[model samples]
Target: MTKFILTAFNPANGQRARLHYDNATSELTSESGESLVQAVEVVARANAPAVSKQTPLAKSSPRVLKISLGLSCNYACEYCSQRFVPRADETNPGDVQAFVDGLDSWVTSPPEKVEFWGGEPLVYIKTMRPLAEAIRSKFPNAELSVITNGSLLNDEINDWLDRMGFSVGISHDGPGQPVRGPDPLQDPEQRAAIMALYARLAPQRRISFNAMVNRENASRAAIQRFFIELTGDPAVPIGEGSFVDAYDEGGIAHSLRPGELHAYRNLAFHEIRTGQAANVQAVSSKTASFVNSIRSRRPASSLGQKCGMDKTESIAVDLRGNVLTCQNVSAASTAPNGQPHHIGHVSDLAAVKLNTATHWSKRENCPSCPMLQICQGSCMFLEGPLWDRSCDNAFSDAVPIFAAGIEFLTGLVPFHIEGELRDDRKDIFGFSEQVKPSRDRPPRVFPIPVVAA
Candidate 1:
């Protein structure tokens, strides 16, 4: 029988829920199934438990590590949650080495995958190269990826990436006039550069676009059309969708106008339902099923519910070797007393403790929200000055607006109706049929050379 393991890491409770599966029988049964809450409970129990016990569970290796190289970024997007920028004097080799060493030791057995992230990873390519090389040498089996802006990509970087079998996730805001800041490149030039990279590297490497939806771009139907056109190719991976909420200078949540908010929600929902968006295609069948199951348990008011930073599979580390509990918060807040915390230099393999209690909590307030299952208590950093507090008002207000928009968009695409309405007979989101056609659709032609695999 094919065996599968499912583990749920609850940072809030500092506990895990693990399930072992028998694929042949399509059943989840554990060695301690009778005593476990669910089949996956076995896997969770293998990690930390929600409740304390005399004999602690064996620690399981993390399945993925999201290493945040630093807070430095090239763009100053208005809605940026972390508010990161390249700090000229902040990049330290000692700190990078410490974190690398810790990761090497922590993952001696290694996880299923590892991803490198940054304000812009290319900025520190020199520092990152050696580490990437080391990881490749140590864990040949690990799936490696880098989340970058793609502005600094060149032949040399591309060659390195090809050799490492690295997957690339490029962050761009479709063809809407630059809302985040000045265009990284001027009009035609910018588009050309982006397309060039896509053509040269996409076939050989797994590449996808992450587009943040906001008011300026979402308001323009042309922008959405441009997105569809840009990523429509079968060979070229397309857009990955994410919501960008406007924030005030103090980092407090700012209210979005009902219409603007509605537009953003509509676009995201439309993309998911129609399979017009990018990364949606790449989401695993199992993970998609899990998300749909959670959605079915909630009412219409919580469509975008469990979608946030915490549910993500990666963790963030900074230039100073500080391991951030969550990347959504500013660097200062991620550290103790709002000061940066360092794990160790890149060369030392030491375990580090995160004071998660301060930034994460699951309270009564959360259970009452209709989107609780989907949202899982919202962004940890957005809860309050201390992470433990609940953002009750924010949760209640945002759910309905988002849900309405999602529903409206899904309605526009007839194919998704059965899936959205929870008809068991239909495949989840009608994914099997819709996604393949959408992906096979012809892409708009561009001048760049399509990279050969």
Candidate 2:
């Protein structure tokens, strides 16, 4: 017998209600109250035809093991928070061993996804190879992925990923040259090499791109054109756009002018809408019709937010062994006191609690937002007192981009709903508009003011 789980949030009492349905006799029962069964029966009879089990939606896993392979990077992107560059002295065998050992224990207990992030993950391919090999051998079921600038990926690294069965996410900001520090546009050779590598790896690997949109590169027409060409295939998932505040440890590197911000929003929306339309066309006509209907009926506000790097869904570890709550947090602060204290091991429930608590406390403003579930309050490091002074800038910039994405995908939903929803579909877009201008807000910067040691 098939089962359907029904879950509803009771706004009046701030509680959750769960009900289960049995497909055989079309019976329903509430898991909590004694009268729940009667209520379910009444609803079941009223609805008739079918009864499905009420399974609670699986909460996202908060366990993310970020193995920071060291603070080494090849490209000098202007907005890079880590200020990363390839440094031989930074890589420590002892640190790597401790991290791997800690990860092994973490997987044994709660079992979480492992993400390799860094100045650039490919810098330590040797360390990564063995680590990936070990994790796949031991944890078989644990999800593994990597976030790299893609400047250093070669055939060997691609092969390693393919053999180990890992997903890959590459970072690039289309084409704009904001002088990183001194070197203008990241090495031209490096960029070309990355593109070549992507082309070669695209067919076999689950590859995605992350473009950090900012004022310098926010040309909507250019961005839309680039995305159209990049994700021409409907089957392939489109890349993501993240609005980045231009700055590093030094100070504000650049800020988006009001005009640039408006243009960027329009471009992002266009990309999303066009991308969805193309994807729907690739599917059966019957499905496309359904998508149109849904698009017409659904309120723009009703569309959900895109799934991003959430604390509950993922976390990051620094070059030392400090496990951070998320990537943005990892990027904002160097190991506290530069000692690299272990925040929490991957397998440790303590880590989950610390990360979750840190995330919740940092996201105090989120509880009131309409798009809380979708935004998950965005990156804490980007919000709060950590980096940007404005609480709403992150999501404010994100909403236009995210909403466009939702319109695009929902526009195509008619075609793919009957079949299994692709994992990529969950990456929808929706953002709230309750944002205050940074200039008008009180400054609450993080890495709290410390006297020079």
Specify the highest-lDDT model's number: 1
Model 2: per-residue Cα lDDT over 20-101, one tens digit each: 4332232334545232322111111121111001111111333665566766666666777665322324555445566657
Ten residues in a row with the worst lDDT in model 1? 44-53
Residue-level lDDT for 85 in candidate 1: 26
Q: Pick the candidate with the highest TM-score.
A: 1
Clashes of each: 23, 15
Q: Candidate 1 local accuracy as lDDT?
A: 0.44
Steric clash count of candidate 1: 23
User: lDDT per residue, candidate 1, 38-83, as tens digits?
Assistant: 2222121121121111211122235666666665777666656557
N/CA/C clash count, model 2: 15
